[model samples]
Target: MTERPADEKDIVLAAQRGEQAAFSELVRRHQRRAYAVARAIVINHEDAEDAVQEAFLHAYRAIDRFLPDQAFGAWLHRIVANAALDVTRRRKVRDADELPETVASPFRDPAEKGELRARLTEALNTLPARQRAVIVLHDVEGYKHAEIGQMLDIPEGTARSDLHYARSQLRQVLGALRQS
Candidate 1:
């Protein structure tokens, strides 16, 4: 039989058998989305890159135990997201004085677009980490609430509540920005 390109199941099996090449292919397939998810959560490019690297390493180490039926990309995304969250938590605790600043973008019309981006970032920063993660994953990253709940290990109801709360907070922040 001619050797065909391994499907996800084949790759998983090969990875379980300790095939590093198969594992590398898995990483190549999911790396961009994984990094994007990490970047959204961590918000710092360097930190996100580090988190992605750590996540991939963790995934490789843990792949043998991964459920065969689960989508590997989603599984990897969860790992990356968790790693990013850890980075955020550690950074926050390490430097309480180094709170994130909302800087206006220079490329857009300085008067309008800059203010909008700043206000959005401010509102996002105000949310609890879980809520922010849910919002970014669901709204920004285009994951469904169920997928987000699975990735974050939260109940779907909790994810919904977080999304609602995040939306409300952003609205309030935008209103305040308009008033100011």
Candidate 2:
């Protein structure tokens, strides 16, 4: 008889047993969400990609320690968040390569939208790394405070506090931009 398809639990179990193909399957499954998580933190395309790669390698190395009862997506996101923070600290972010025509283009997107995006990005950058992680994980990525705390290895209260402060700071900064 043919074998049944492996479910996520089966995949994790196989991975825990050191099955390389199983781990590869896990990576394939989570890579897009992982990239989104990394991108939200790093705010740069190449750096986010690097973070995802590094996180997967780290996860592969540490997969044996993963508790099967826990949520694998949560566990993986925690690593991805840390990897993005690490990437930011490891080197200065490179400037995007833009052609002069593109840079000088008068046909860019609407001014208000561009300005708002720039302001939001600037505000996010001002936050401390953990605060950024908390806010982005909670707000942008739609993780609960408890899930964020677990991913960040902080108390749930701390995650809530961090998110509050991060949001407050963003509002203050971006609010000022709107008035001026």
Candidate 3:
């Protein structure tokens, strides 16, 4: 008889027992979502990559302490979010001196789309970090407020309020961009 592949809980269990390959499998399975969570916070590609790598390293180190009763992905997502926030905090001083670059979009007129993307990025960056994270986790990633609260360590009501505030801010910013 052939052996079936291990499930997530089994892989996590194996990893907890010091199986490196099992942890690698978990990373491979969840890397995209991890990266997305990191990127949504940090906003820069290289910083997001660094944050994800850092999150994975942190996760690997703590795997032995992981409880299999909770969802592994949720645990990882929270780590990634925290790592991204750390990266954002560290990059603030460095970012002040960096010039912004506009990428031309092939789908729309280069200038218009590039300008729009830049404006949107600016709008997102202006929000308070918690609000930004809440909006990104909820609207962009389609996570529920309860899940966001769990990941962010906030009350569910706080997450909902942050999302409301973030959306309102973005709408005002985007409206100004449209008029100008």
Candidate 4:
């Protein structure tokens, strides 16, 4: 007889008990989505990857505090989002002394890059981290308001408002892109 794979609840229970393999399973299962969340926030692939790694490490250490009844993915994504935002903050501080104009932009590297994506990325960066995260989670990742709220540790109504405001800001900023 073939063995059934352990369910998430069981995995969470085991991980909370200090089982290394169970935590490893959790990491294996959620790392890709975590990377996507981090990537949406950080923009840079290297920074996103680092954020994902740091989030997983923090999750592992904090696993004992996690409740199996709660949604593990949401909890993990929250950590991933925070880590990604930290990277962006650190990067801004590190680059504060230099003008961005002095460096060649990734946007200009490929002539075929979509103008809309570039414009959208810039617009997203202008918003507050929470608002940016809400918009990306809702529109780009297709997460519902409640799920986004849970992942970001905000109220569902706040998530909705954030998304609405973020969309309005992006629309205003990128209005020229639509015209062209």
Top TM-score model: 3
Q: Which consecutive 10 residues in model 4 have the weakest lDDT in total?
A: 104-113
What ranges in model 2 sit over 4 Å off? 1-6, 92-113
**Every candidate's lDDT:** 0.83, 0.83, 0.87, 0.84
Candidate 3 global lDDT: 0.87
Question: On residues 1-180, what C-alpha lDDT tens digit does candidate 2 reach at each position?
Answer: 123236777788888888778888899899999998888778878989999999999999899999988889989988998898888877443334433454544433447557667768878988877898889888888989998887778899999999999999999988876666
Error of 4 at 53 (Å): 0.9
Tens digit per residue, CA lDDT, model 3, 80-164 = 9999889988888777898879774535443764777887888998997778888888888999999998887889999999999
Candidate 1, residue 25: CA error in Å?
0.9
TM-score for each prediction?
A: 0.85, 0.81, 0.87, 0.84
In the range 1-180, model 1's lDDT, one tens digit per residue, is: 124346887887788889888888888888889888887787678988998999999999999889979888888888888998898998888878775588755454438657677667777887877788888888888989888888877889999999999889888877876666
Model 4 ranges off by over 4 Å = 1-4, 101-112, 178-180
Model 2: lDDT to the true structure: 0.83
lDDT of 3 at 116: 70
**Candidate 1 — what's its lDDT?**
0.83
Worst 10 residues of 1 by lDDT: 104-113
Best of the candidates, lDDT? 3
Q: How many pairs of residues in model 1 come into backbone collision?
A: 0
